[model samples]
Target: MKYKKLIFSSIGISLFCLVILLFFVLRGNFFKYTDINSMISEPKTNSLIVSGTWELSSITSLSDGSEVKSSEEKLYITENFVYFEKMGTTNPKFKFRQVNFKNYLLYNGVVTDKINIDTDDVIVVSIRDERNFYKEFIVLDKNKIATIYNKKYYIFEKKSDNVDKSIIEELSLDESSINPKKDISFLIGVKSIGTKDVDYETFLIRKNGDEKPTADKVEGLFVNNKNKFFLVNANENEVFVTNDYINNTNKISLGVKNATINFLSKNYISLESYNAETNKKNYSIYKIGELSDESQMSIKDIAGDKGEKAYFNDIRKLGYSSDNINLYDMKNFGVKRNNFSWVFKGILSNYSHDNFVSSEIDLDLIPNVDIFSNKSSKISKLRVKEKVPDVLDYFVSPDESVIVILTADDISMYEIKNQEIATLPIFTTSLKNRREVVTFQWTNAISSELTYTEFMKIKRSN
Candidate 1:
């Protein structure tokens, strides 16, 4: 009996020690689960929170009861603010708010409410209206979020934070061994002409070609590839085409006096001229090789007639959109004294053969570029805390992944997917007295290889 009692006591002591150890282990895990700092760390290191950018992948609409897939709409969430970009908007809609571990408050905006959090990592946002009260539940995970609203689900995916190592080689084109153009990577280099008569000195930098192609005298320039480029010289009243080499140039006379020419694409060029006989403005599209008129449509025909006269200022092909182009028109309606003007009007239009949509723009606000998807279109406006420098030229990538904005002193590249910006190593050589002209030629062959190095640089620089 004594031996059995001693063995039982030994077993009880062992069991007591195991319970103590198990309690501490479970306590440590509980602390980790409730730790707010670990949950909201940078997205690069942590994935279990909603702290970075989430792009709209698919959304179910309650109004029409239809499902729409949208890649252009984005939502950026930080500790301080929540910025949202909807389809067809020229600027990001922002709301000032504060976030905690389990709650958030919108201090200022059209809708002010306190949101709650649940144990399942679901965010519940409630809004009350005169007609109906609504609730939205956003289910969060490491890399995806499903936002439920009005009996619809809006899915978002977290953008990848990985940096592509190939960017260093792509940007460092001068040091590469392979042919730049042949391998699908090319860089745009612009040299300013010091002379007053010429405006642009543009050339393409490729590994297989000569050090630099001859710079052309062009008022407006567009490049399809290293072998083909189009130029418009209003002073000469001609549209020049160069193929195989820049020295081999062909000219086609437009036969319009005081006409402003813009290169639309390899196949089309837009001509804006004043008709003295009719005392009105005329716009026409001409084929590149034949210089034949393709379409002769007035501004009023496309955009409804306002009381004021409109002048075509610029035109560019919308990226990712199916043959859709944007036309910009400016009119001076108010009085001007020296440098000050009372009113200036600007109009932007999305134009295609079958459809036309137009909207007015404010001159006081910075202009935004429009991005269109199959289901919806979104406008991306520059929203910077500081004043932005004067933009000399800008180019959008073929995939609509990035945009490069060139100024007199520096070049800034913005990533649309991650909502990040980086400045490239290239600089401009234009002097103060000379006209500063910078243009970009985007090629699918080269842009597809760009990596996350540029995006990572932006974060490190900040």
Candidate 2:
């Protein structure tokens, strides 16, 4: 009888302890859930917020056979229409048709123009032929009703309204001009000229008569109106253009001792320097070089010293976004800066494509981590409903409010407001590597006329 009583007493104690522990656990989770909900419920000042994970396309296999998809897709958003290009697979003989996203939706596929997409007065660049590389580069400017193509030395413009009247002329190219064509990443726009062998001298031509021989390998060329030119390059380092052009000397030094003087644009440049004492990564930047000497300052040094503890870490990727260019100091745990304890460099706009905002981060920084943002203020990571690895690509809206994350297992769109979660889309894809998810978000201007203006203009192309 005594032994039975002792066992009952011990059991009751254990139960009480277990209940207390469970209560703490539940309380912690409840607080976290509440925090996320509060973050999502905040009001947004921006009109539309869009963001997402960019991924390569996937192949869907039916009982019949397998299909392939190409990865060269871009999103073009204008005041009237949103254009999307989805690349389809080529035939066995190496021929393929670029999948017109709009045509696919028109062919009874489950795709709909968003409520905000104006379709009536809409005109878009059509990829007539996908297999032809040269024609693929041709983007028809709908506003001018013309098709623009790239020639070796000039931009050929052809009116889409009247296809016969195409203006094919050399864009301000002379005997002294040498246009260096780069076929690598088709994201940047400016065409570079001058001595290829030389390190710091390149004749950056923005528009005709807007020619300037800039002496910094890192200073890129921006041509505004006619003669107005802006050089986006590092000015402080050895790479620089003299105040006066070299009138006497015809031949300049073709090579540079500093091999890292590669000018990406007037707003950005890449410099290479080495430190002897601490073996630190040495990079120099001259932001706003065209201005007075007081204005010209070293961007790298400013970003580097922001952290209280200047631990020497390798800067993998760095560039500006919006107004400020940021450099990511990679030291295992993603970007390390003393600025905000966990903040990173802001992304920059892609100068070549007005549609894209250019930003760079080393692949090593925050690899495999999901990045989410609420358009107005908050950006965070999403809790994975399921485990999946390998994200192919990501897409964020121009406003940076909503994000669609596509993985090997599923694709989802998350709505964020301020610093919180508002909604997760009900529609989820079970396919692996589901690519080409359209990213969209809500805006304050929810008028029907503004949303559906382009819808009225859809007509048969005669």
Candidate 3:
């Protein structure tokens, strides 16, 4: 009986040793394949950005270090001016007010501006409204600013410019800011800013001479030169585009279903169907200038099964390139020691005619982009350090050779030549309200083209 007991004890000791060995083996293997140090050590660039939980107010700093304060809920800045939105303590609606940071430093009196200027000076402001309304604006020039408030886009020139006696041809105040370039002026959010509520079934505000935008409900607007696009929210789905807004209504098989759209280029659009079974996600590329049915081509199953629901959590609008788009996605390879599920993932950007770059996040939380030159069958990984905790937003150059990653604290400009990454931490104030509502969070990763880079860049990074 003593010998039997000794044998049992020996068996238990062997089992314990095996478990310890296995744990170390797995950990060592993970590190061996993925270089964590080199990636994290890369340089970072900063921007004058704001940071905080639930950011409602913010301050901007001049290169000199003097800070400018303003309401955080709605912050807008131009070369010479800035504005904010505010609602009285007991008021039900919001109003607009201008701010002068310089005056705040001199004395605490109200700072209001009726004119726009062209300078580096930054200001803060708050306004009050009678109804639940939001306002956005674009500073046109000193003494003039274009803005959209209470569902109307208006060009607010200096009140002094009002030559009241002659024929008095007044510009409409029912619209928001307008992109005025000589003869071309692009308006956005038309129905939202118009006097009548039409629910804006299909709309596009562009230069009167150029092609109109193609979208069901353009909620967000972006423009570069003659190229203008809208983040169209149709039925719940989004379609990203500049022109060709009218063609989609009669082409796609969207039977009242909403979707999200990301404009890739004239020939391609990144689309995601939210009403799919099990939250299934897909990417479709449509031919430019062609109708939806004639131009659209979709890829069904992506990221396998795990990505069915997890895909929704990782969608963001990074940036677009002529041929290549840059975006990030999350991955769940395994868990870490702290019991926090290891979020091991990075960017999956497309470039150069089907050429792709798949990146992985190291343990130190930096991305090492893996270049897959399929045309040449060559694979290379470039390690880049991120100043931000995680890459939240990005803007890509036309050639996809450079990208600007916007993080909570800074914005870094990354160039794809010789693997160089520059960090730029911005000098912006941190507020409470804006940070909590509009910012990046976290999620999982998958391998599929069905997922648009837009979704991956915008989804809150956890």
Candidate 4:
């Protein structure tokens, strides 16, 4: 009986030891692969671009160091697809379908060209010197992770910003900065084109009588009545401006997303910015190259026109008007027009093509641009069909004295009868402009383009 009791005790001890051995072996292997470092030792970590599969991480704000945690949702990335999964749900795999890289999914499909399903094991964004070093990136720090939820991308930044501030100061960049290996180039805009061989300015085109822009990438030029500014090189993050059409090159740093001449205004200007990622609106007022207290006002109190729902289509739209519809401070004004589309409505703008454009409806109707005469209530319709042959973009002088039309293959500006746009441009010997929305100082304003709400207020007060 004593020998039988000893044998039973030995069997129990051996079974317990085997179970312990298995747990340790499995746990070590699992954690070694899956556990991301809580504090990344280096500043640049692998890319956490929201695609494929990613567990929700805590979100940090750059405006203020606040963090929000949502860990239940799981959207992960594999080679072919970026899909969503949730823990306690009947539908574990939320992704509806697999799609090609050329297609941008409007619903239930994740699209990305940055990843190689066969080669890329981890998502990464790197910044080194030369072309090979560049990869698609929109980020704050290494610890920053972006997650997908509610059909939107949420960037989760680390609470601590460990990047060197001197680089940001020298480059005139905002707080969320990264240090490149050598001279830093702030190529900030999204990858407009997928193929790496294509130059960066494929979409954000520049203006020159010559051929296309020679740079690998370029920030599109912006001009206003008083100033004209453009990035010297998108890679350098250097900014230069021309004052008063005199071709005076002076350096000025700007925080605005897009620009026209006098973008900085050298005095005061108000702008509202919406983050396409988070859908947050930032109302800012710049005074002599600085943000002012007026920027702190409620979005309701901010001056100028709040972009309203287009009186046109089911598409989400906005009404953008000139600062003062009647004022013609600059001689010639240019509005950047691109992406003319051939739809069932004949020809229409598939995207926002004009600076003072709010009339997608009328653009679909015909090729005539309607202008409301400020001198009288009469509307003057310019027959644009005659000038729109392979037209990429065009410019009009503020006084309606000149019109420079840029087509896919040629640039033309010659005098015609008194249809208003019929004189030599005051500043340019040739019809060349690199700016986006120049001050359109015509005596007759494009009534359809002006912001309806803001236009009424200015006209009533006038």
Candidate 5:
């Protein structure tokens, strides 16, 4: 009888201990906190408030005192795991544990335990391993966040949960901004030629022109007004000039062999050539005139000393500026490309060249639009809309009254004075097609070309 009572008592004690353990686990009290008092007095909630998508805006390195701006990198925080998309890498998730009231521990390939939450909007995380020591202090709000990681500072903005539906709507043109006397037209589309498609013919969507322009194999097109227009034919290595758009009066040969016209402006046009032997780029610029007898001029001759360091590969003439141009310096951002770089670094100093003088401007913030005005001889920075697309192309109007942004499937117009964005209609055959299939070129301040149905007619017959 004594042995039986002892066995029963042992079993009861074991069951009671198991129940206690289960209660603690269910109540989330298994981990004990240190005696250190937390500065924040907010009580712990049942759910995580930091679960959202955060986009990288800017990064500042304390070691070199240099800042890099970006609109691409993103971070996804969830209840179970945290995902990071830094540089060019995709989302890599790590399992996280809420060790304390606001503390967390992340484990993937390694363990990071010193994650401390100072408040609902601030967190300080530290990690030390055999090879590296990582630390970050993060401050976050509803729309924006700033973080300091290992002496490097970073800024991020929260992404919107809802998609923008305004892109499909028609664009409202500002009547006051438009010139009533001048006739504006846009080269909207191109039609494939020949039975087997030997060439492409351009078409125009006129805003005020009496008759549309006609051209063949037009690789590039630039319009100053209804009276002045320029077209390039790379196959013939010739540039055709038209005064009335009905007939080509002059044909000018490109100075370099195998040269292609890359960019065209109102007063100047640029040609690009590649050296097969040396693998270097050679660029030439020509002043547009009614007479075809003008010779090609070096960029250095046209832009003077400023053209020496100017990037001709991605040169863009700001229509709003009478004499100023936007020079894209990609080397500062560690990118080797022929496209425009969104970020730039320079000292705030007065810049004067020829009749133009661009005032100094600072661009240390992200999601900013820097407008270089030739009329004012000043560069102004404006904080525009937030939560824009990752990859986009933007154009400012001639009067600096409006800005247009084009993405893969959408076009949005922003008013400079009000800072309000309105979605513009995309005149394409299909909305499901990717933006890469469409070709868009801005011809003038109020005109552009949006081409679709490229080589589609050939595929349809087969």
Candidate 6:
């Protein structure tokens, strides 16, 4: 009787547990698991990541089943666009959607539209390429994928670990690299920026209650000490100009053969045309406001050079972003009383793109000197609070709000807030074989548009 009772109790407990499991599964909590591999259906509750950069690993001719040369092209997959670049030419891409983001299908190129991709699982990827043809791809595994384009089976291996890495690389190109003939990545580097017009003349609350605006009458004057108020898009090769940055009816091709914008300042803009095959460069200059071309939004050229500025207290200005950003030691200002900290400042006047936060970190207000006493308030100020690093070199963001400090050991980024350099870094990553890197620039390559009105404002203010 004891044994029978125990058996019955065990059976009842097992039955109750089974029922509880079934109930939870039906209620969806059990199914709402968080395994990245459990990407079984659409609207997955689990967070699944998609690969962004895929290098062409191998190729095979589908018709003959024979080996082929590698094109070295890379597949850069963005949230909405899938680009096949490095074809030894400009990039080409198309819109895409997905099946649990595992399978990709061509879309109508509308960002907000809900795209339903009901295709066979065998077609891991598909694109409606030019000439209205379909390109199909198959997934080999989690790290590899194969696509068939024009009777050729091309296999690609995922390079970047995740999509964000690819996006950052794509977004971080120098503003000068934004050529209309280039891929969508460079094109988006600039076209995505916004513009603003702020009023001046009356002192707005300067941090810690400094000077008010330059005037009393406040109106949306076309110029701010932040960014240029304009827009620039383009066509295939030497696209037409949008002179006013708003109107496009008058189409005149800028004769400047897609030269890289080299120098930008309050008065002049320069373009450098490079002969890649010959390894040569030619420079040209244009006055501000009267600027043309590019999908980039920054104000000027990076003034590319293999040279580094001389040590602390070197007065020879090292021109960077738009010829504005410069790193200076306290010695540079002729303060021989005591050795001191090096500061960086950039002119973000009259062309603040994205945000006006840069105003807080402007050319003046650093070294917190008596504004009335300084012989030169002509330069802005960004003091790095005394904690100097073994900085081999540094790069400033276009807006000059942050700076990338490169040392012998690692690369670190710091936020330039008013009077406070964050004790902690935003990020620090070590680069392998630092000596092997021949050319490394951490800026976007995009062209820009400066309207006549805004240009005039900048020139007059300066």
Which window of ten consecutive residues has the lowest lDDT sum in model 6?
A: 184-193
Best of the two (4, 6) by lDDT = 6
Using lDDT as the measure, the top candidate is 1
lDDT of each: 0.38, 0.28, 0.29, 0.29, 0.36, 0.35
**Regions more than 4 Å wrong, model 2:** 1-237, 247-259, 288-462
Model 2: lDDT to the true structure: 0.28
Q: For residues 189-264, could you state the per-residue lDDT of candidate 3 as single tens digits?
A: 2122222222222211212222331111123332222122323333343333433333433323332245433322
User: Which candidate gets the maximum TM-score versus the true structure?
Assistant: 1
* lDDT score of residue 32 within candidate 3: 43
lDDT of 3 at 210: 26
Tell me how far the alpha carbon of residue 396 in candidate 2 is from the true structure, in angstroms, after superposition: 28
User: Could you tell me every candidate's TM-score relative to the true structure?
Assistant: 0.35, 0.23, 0.24, 0.24, 0.33, 0.22
Which one wins by TM-score: 3 or 5?
A: 5
Question: Which candidate, 2 or 5, would have the higher lDDT against the true structure?
Answer: 5
Q: RMSD in angstroms, all models?
A: 17.2, 25.1, 28.0, 26.0, 19.0, 24.5
| Runs in model 6 lying further than 4 Å from the true structure | 1-50, 86-123, 126-136, 163-462
- Tell me how far candidate 5 lies from the true structure as C-alpha RMSD in angstroms: 19.0
Q: Residue 158 in model 5: shift from native, Å?
A: 51
Q: What TM-score would you give candidate 6 relative to the actual structure?
A: 0.22
Q: For candidate 6, write residues 1-462 as lDDT tens digits.
A: 999999999999999999999997875754434443333333322222334678887666444444544655676654444445312112223322233332232222222122222334421444443322234455555677776454455778989755565454554342222222221110001110122211111111111112111111111112221233322223324423233433334544455554433222233333434456634333333433454544222212211111122221122233224344433211111111002122222322223574322221212112211111112111133343244445554444333334545554655566555424567766565533231111111212231232223434433443
Residue 283, candidate 6: Cα error in Å is 39
